[model samples]
Target: MSQHQILSTEPKPFVKWAGGKRQLIQTIDRHIPVQFGTYFEPFLGGGAVLLHLLGKNPEMKCRVSDLNSDLVLSYVTIRDRVEELITSLQTHAKNYHKNPDSYYYGVRESEPKSQIEKVSRLLFLNRTCFNGLYRVNSKGKFNVPLGRYSNPNIVNEENLLSVSRVLQSKKIQIICRDFAAVLSDAKKGDFVYFDPPYQPVSKTASFTSYTNKDFTYEDLANLVDVSEKLSDKDCKVLHSNSNSKEVRDLFSKEWKIVEVAANRSINSDSTKRTGQKELLIKNY
Candidate 1:
């Protein structure tokens, strides 16, 4: 309706993502290096920083990747098939509004045959499911319960359209790859951002079921090694993770770690969700 509203909503992250960087964009933005060659984001969750950077610099070339195939498929679908996605989402919205509770579970358990249907299922479940979390069981199934929303925005037409336009507007390369593997192509002057699953604060607080696979402590160490290597190669790196002792020690030897406050909003217990300390490590 207005330019301000359009800018506020345009080309935003289409799907809800766990540990998404939307709220931390500005804090991270101030630390983003002045100039760089290509932009590479390995842990492209909802791509808040990626989308924001691209929107501000429309010509910025980018390569984004994630380990989750379904998540990556959703991105590819929205980027290449926004029209079809909108149609499918509209259909889902129509059916969901008719009978939300029953319809939510039905869609949750559904096994779609086509890419469009698969992505539609994912987006539909994400919008309606608990807290927009992307957790799955050991069998790789979507298991988050229905969110407590009287009216979930199942089909944000304008946002989806804007996402498509932004994807089409740039030379953004989307791929499904292991986060560390994606950085092998990184060269000097390339800015790389890592938003890997945050290391858990405690044993009971772990929630890294993004796929059937788990991102364990070893995985965090492996990522630390990757960051060190990237730093050695003179590639600018920015990473975010829980502000735990293990994470700090891993990078303290050779990186800049900044404390960032982020809201832990996805927890079922409202009391547990509050401003938590997180660390954003960088190698400049």
Candidate 2:
């Protein structure tokens, strides 16, 4: 089918993600072109946008990557063995609901014997973890405590099958590496979307690190440099970050940066948590 025709299909994901961009789908769709060579997402967190795009434009080629190996492994597992992963998740849910603390930390503490087992444990922990947050210590362990939710959806079988179908059609590339490295393969006419760790707008609001490693100032600058080079080569770029002054200053030259409001989730106080502005840098 033609690209325009394919885009008419409704897109949806089967997972509940903490920082998922379901609300921003329309906003992103408005900025993105109707046609592009390939869609590249370097920081593939929940993959809400990627799944949406795949469903909307099944004919479009796409690539997704993440710095977190476990996250990548889960996605790859879902793509390759959706049934197996779903079964494992169902088994976990059955046992977890019985003994919340024990099962929660059991998956957290148990060492996976294989890749699928690793993926299963990761997904189980992610669903039951506090606030659906993906955080790890320096020792590379799942540390998020069990949440209050009694019955979290563990097996998103339909969505997993959809993702797998999308993978089968196009030359979809999945990588687990630094975001900068993905730019090496980017060429003119390619579309790249970056959603990095939020450079905290305030010191107190910083949380949700996927690993002990923090995204440094150098990483942000390197991203800007790569985006600039991509723009020079006529590759469309869009990046989402906190609307901090430092971030604005860095991309002010090349990007058409706009401040858009979003909620701050790093804090525990519900009353203090409200809408705050964030920057969306684009070179279209």
Candidate 3:
């Protein structure tokens, strides 16, 4: 298919990410370098921005990574073995539609042996689980209870197909590594976008439980140092984090910081979810 055709039917994020940039796409797009070298996204959560870039320039060179190995495996499976995945998801959707309650928790407890089964289980849990929030217990097992949706979209074939196509056609590198480690190959002229787990908005407002591990203040400091080094090497850097005094203090005056309103997906109270401020920092 032509790039224009794909662009017309652009593939969006398949998962409901906690810190997803779907709502902030236009705002972040405005800051992307008009023309640049390879693209690097160390914290590739949900990959909303990466999809936007692929839509704009199908041949764009990109390297995307995440700390979540299961998430990375899902991305690779979708890209390389989407047909098999679709078949697997179809079975999940049918069974889920038949018995939402029993099937949901059963699969949650049951472990799958194959890669396809594992990816399918994760995707199914993501779609049907509470708020689509990916959280793990201290034992590193998914523990979110099943959501109360009457009809969850367990088989999102369209978005999955489009995402698979984009991954197959584009010059993209998908890896399972630490953010800083995957960033080692970054060179001058490359544009690195960081969208790590946001700095906590309040004492108990952290959403970093995507993995068993948490992104502490020390990691944030390390990320800031990495971003600065990348900037010094002449790489265009753009990052997104919670709008907080500590986050603001992490970056120097050389980087431009812009505040934008984003809705918090995890909030139960609808009124409390809106108008939450997030910071977008860039070194142009």
- Which 10-residue span in candidate 2 carries the lowest summed lDDT? 6-15
Model-by-model lDDT, in order? 0.86, 0.76, 0.88
Candidate that would win on lDDT = 3
Give the residue spans of candidate 2 off by over 4 A: 1-19, 264-266
Error of 1 at 265 (Å): 0.4
Candidate 3: misplaced stretches above 4 Å? Answer: 1-8
Q: How badly does each model clash, as a count of residue pairs?
A: 0, 0, 0
lDDT (C-alpha) at residue 233 in model 1: 86
How good is model 1 by TM-score? 0.95
Predicted candidate 3 versus true structure: per-residue lDDT over 9-95, tens digit per residue: 788988877788998899899889888899999988799999999978889999999988988999999999998998999999998
Error of 3 at 210 (Å): 0.6
- Evaluate residue 200 in candidate 2 and report its C-alpha lDDT on the 0 to 100 scale: 68
lDDT of 2 by residue, 1-284 (tens): 45444345444554445455776777777777676898899988888788778776667787789887877877787768877887888899889878988878878889978887888887777778887776777777767788888678776555556665666664787889888876778888999999888776778766546767878778789888888888888898999888787788888575798776666564568777677667788986
TM-score of each: 0.95, 0.90, 0.96
TM-score of structure candidate 2: 0.90
| TM-score leaderboard ranking | 3, 1, 2
What range of 10 consecutive residues in model 1 has the weakest lDDT sum? 1-10
Per-residue accuracy of model 1 over 1-284 as CA lDDT, tens digit each: 55456556647888778888888888889989999988999889898898888788878988889988888898888889988998999999999999999999998888989999999998888889888887889998888899889999988888887777778755789989998885578999999998898888888888777878889889989998888888888999988899899888887656888898888776779998787889888877
